[model samples]
Target: MNRFRFRIRFEDRVGMVRDVAEVVSGHGANILSLEVKPGEMHIQVDQVSPTVLENMLKRVQTIANVLEVTPVEWLPHELAQQRLRAILDTVEEGILVVDARGTVSLCNRKAAEILGLGHSLIGNSLKHLGFPREILTSLGVGRLSQQEILLSTPYGRLRCLVKSQPLVDEEGKPAGAMITFEKMSQVRRLVQSLTQPVMITFEEIIYASQKMAEVVALAKTVAKSDSTILIRGESGTGKELFARAIHMASPRRDNPFVVVNCAAIPDTLLESELFGYANGTFTGALKGGRQGLFEFAHQGTIFLDEIAEIPPYVQAKLLRVLQEGCVRRLGEMLENKVDVRVIAATNRNLEEMVAEGSFREDLFYRLNVIPLYLPPLRERKEDIPALAWHFIQKFNQRLGKNVRSLSEAALRRLYDYDWPGNVRELENVIERAMNLAQGERIEPENIILPEKNLASKSPSGLKRAMEEIERQAVIEALNQGGSVRKAAKILGVSHTTIINKMRRYRISGKTSGQWK
Candidate 1:
């Protein structure tokens, strides 16, 4: 037996389809399916022999006003299914269409993958997939919006965002619904890729010095661990950047990467902001209370910048959260558990703060589990040219300018000057220069160094600036010669004078910083 489908064209007359059916029956062939229009018809028939099928085709054309008879690869319904399958497979999200009775009628490849099921899902009851019996109640029959749900599968708990649209017949009667499942994994990946500037990885940190490279390498190593990371650096040295990079590299990268500027929030409101507050705890509080950053960052990372500025009361609460993996809302006795990775950053010396009683000592120890020290831009001056050029390209997009590169004189000035504000300040300088530039190239006169940034990089302004230059010259001479006498020869000074200057400036191999 063989199944054959055909397209037949005939005149719009009474008994035309009857005439075609009689031809198929005369050949001892059973017509399995059929659809007809005014001048055309389509059908599928289970035939007994190829000779009979050929005879049926020839005999159908011989009928009155039957202009032509042709064979098609698929019946109308089968062809519609083939095209629907092709379209559903092209979509990324998992798709399923179930009948009103809750029997699965269609399932796509991605739906099977998301369910982690090996067998076909069609004809199976929704209850078999952990769906509630009352899920498609009369109220929800015609409309189902996107809602997150958890389904238990062979693999584990499957979390997905599901949306449903009801199908309807020509009479507007209820039909099966089309449901789409957006896997939580895909959602996490999309979040990590969003917010271009803030979602930084290790590659975004610009550097050309061995010291910065070593620091980055260490950061990469520690990022693999789940220990609380403490990033220590001077203000404007990009400690938050390092924190975000660490979170992106960690196992929780797909989850949240929340940041809280500890110094920015007031001392009084800081507790409620971090640990949340009960309803009516304060005049401006929300009615149902709120989820704190820890709760918000569950199964993810939370970066606390300027951690040292947190008050003593908040420090004790933070310590409890670190030790017990939970937080308590203000004005509420109940505590909520949270599984959050902490990555705290501080520019101030935490040890000194602990000793000075400004910050809690135990909390410091907990946060310092995996310490990372970000080197300042001045110590990594070898990267100034590259950093400057990077900023030039970045600003060209924003400022609508075609500044190509910096002049040699501009580059020399950048090298000679101290970057008081680190990488952020460098960006500002480049932006300012690009705005002031009259031509394609930025010249020395276009580079305007600020009088004082967050604070002066040098002490006593010009006097300290001169002393720093002198110190660098003396250090470079000694580094080349390895002795005071040789250094004095290079500096065109006596050995006694070289020794006196080193003592006065506290210059040594350790104090030379990255210059060594």
Candidate 2:
């Protein structure tokens, strides 16, 4: 009896020993003992004949990361060779049998599925298909046995676990080869579905007013593209909520939705957080390297809330990433590629900031590709009742209260009073009233309007400004229509302006109604 000892090193830590053992057993060498060590290993086998020892050594050498092979033998030849072939054929994984000429000899069911081909692939050359050329050629020359290869077929791209061993002639020289394959398992279907579910539609936005309806429609338009969207609205206007909805509806929904609040994080930490650093890149660098939000959010969406507060320097970096489609980590030269959809929100006026030089105009243009303006609650007063009811239900469910709805007078008070904080403020008032209400129906006393004087200042100021602008524009228009030329001449406006103004103001200077 001749025993053979072989040493092999594997590239990765996964199931290497099991695979090697399977290959060893297929060669008909009874294992005397096996030893494992970090980055190096030794395998001892009994009953491996001298004739087959060299062929076994050549096959084991082909696995990637193997450094060397030593043949120490104590076994008979014919029995060992037969044992090896049977072991290779009986491998649970699919196998590809190829002669020294690189022609396919036989394959298992799993291998057929992995190649996206039928079991009829016995006569085909691997190079005729999309499997990597180097791996195919290596099998032909008998230099490589096991190679990690990617194959593209009608089914899709597939990652395969490939292990190969050589067939030997009577002289102990390599003849043909056998390649065993295992299909890389995929994550479960439920995980895929949960990660990327269907989107909620505009109708699901939960506002009944025409203003909100229009806002939802606009959001839909923004969601359909990959452009940066700037949502301008007051706090509690559901800016973040809308941002999330837009992300869910966008093409990048399958990826993560990372939210960074510009106002929330300190300026010093924000940049590093957005762009991760390499190992030892800084004082407390994570082991290996830390991935930035951009890397973590690859193929996803990033919501930059309070974008107006982003520092000037950070803005420059962000603009560069957007333009270049890459992110440079704080301490690393390697710029990682990222595909991110940006949805930015702010309560401040970016245009005004641009004019004042606080914001960069080029960055503004880039972010403002799709602008969504959420009207303040007062303008969308028509939605207040439904919105109030919605929030009432929310608080009721949360607080375990049984309040049904509001009283008629309370509803009127809610509509009449101006909401300075918009829908957010409205929700607060409703919640407070629900707490104070003794009965199921919320009443006027339970609801507190903003102080009369405070409410009057805003509504009255807005009304007066609006009325003044309307009145002046109307008067100018009427003057133009009268002379067609004379009134237009007096007003220093075109004759066409006069006729258009008359139609807009609904005034004929000669009519009694117009004079009145």
Candidate 3:
């Protein structure tokens, strides 16, 4: 029954005093007298034990500074115990007292709930409340101090953590003990939410183009919010990739990320597939009916690829799902609630379709809360070199080739050509080159360009035929040499000039060493 006199100082004398009072109150300490000095407070309290006093001082010390602490005896044992018990009862945390015999001496309502029992635990053996007998014995022997244990009850399984402390008599001998516990399941669930895996992520989609980077950045921002996203680009421009990335970045990433290809499915089947049908609704319906992608994707994300190809009737049903947040089977009367985040992508121009009155404008607006536009490969020519190199590496692995790189000359030729099919076309070209190449490096011949037509150089002259014969003779000699330098030396011309003429002649070996 000792009272403590403590002097606490706060930086700037601003809010330090309030913090100190809160810390003391939280630790079951009663302030009997308080007086404020210039930049500090002199606090005196009765019924505060050394443990409570130490905890309070430690907390206040962290704020700014605490000058000193001195103990002053005030209340005796009975009054002090009553006051401490009253204060502890008001706390949210469970509190319990166990005697040296391992019997519960005191218990609070919170403690009962925490341990999956009742405050009637007082006078009962602590072991019966799920505390292991050996652990309780060890606690009485002052060998076991604290531990965490799981307790099973009628309600459910509970995770309980107990901290035990032994009380000593004047002779410094262990006499009694007290244990405090709190539920653990809540903490575990919080941790799981924080560490869950993301189904689709921006990093998963590869891109080195500034155009792609801008699109990714926009997708990341859009994913963090609850907005419907529409991805518009050419078929192979990665519209679907952008949609998946956005869904993975969203808060709903932990949930399912489902995909449906509108163009791939026939119009008649797309409706039943998207919005599940009721039992006996169709010829091939399952025994109990089936859940639609939207239903299964409830509390998740749905990626609708080739969305522009969805038929008009299906478009009406889809619009209803987006607007009403509910779905009704083909023959069902009741509409079931659903929570789905829609991400739509298409290569077609929906705006033009709307202009042509082939698409619903209202549905377009519904899905177009956020529109992500991706540029075609020809428009982003700067990305060609990197993308070309990337494809070369990929195909090299697949082909198990020693292909180390694409020659600068060959790459320049590739960059010069317009890729009508975007990234897909570039990938196809690289695969073709890798298949044709014999060594580690890709040569110009490894690539085959589409033919360009032009008028004959000499439309109506005998000289044209004679010039063609000379050209054939020069190509034949080069084919015999096999090396451009050797060819030039044999043809009696500077190596550079000879190489240029050979290129213009389109001389590759077919008639290896023949002239006619």
Candidate number with greatest lDDT = 1
lDDT per residue for candidate 2 within 397-512, as digits (tens), equals 88889899888999999988777788888988988988888878998999977677775534587776986686566566445444346656667777656544543333454332
Off by over 4 Å in 1: 132-135, 138-142, 191-194, 198-210, 220-229, 243-344, 348-369, 376-422, 425-516
Number of backbone clashes in candidate 1: 0
lDDT of each: 0.81, 0.72, 0.73
Clashes of each: 0, 15, 1
TM-score of 1: 0.63
Q: Per-residue CA lDDT of candidate 3, range 71-161, in tens?
A: 4343344457788878877866677787777788888778877766675778887777777655576655664434545455666545455
Task: Give the TM-scores of the predictions, in the order they appear.
Answer: 0.63, 0.54, 0.50
Superposed by TM-score, candidate 1 places the C-alpha of residue 465 at a distance from the truth, in angstroms, of: 30
Top candidate on TM-score is 1
Cα deviation at 389, candidate 3, in Å, is 1.8
For model 1, how does the per-residue alpha-carbon lDDT over 83-156 read when each residue is reduced to its tens digit? 99899888889887888777788988888888877447888767787654334552227566555455777876
lDDT of 1 at 217: 98
Error of 3 at 208 (Å): 3.6
Sorted on lDDT, highest at the top, how do the candidates line up? 1, 3, 2
Model 1: how far residue 48 lies from native, Å: 0.3
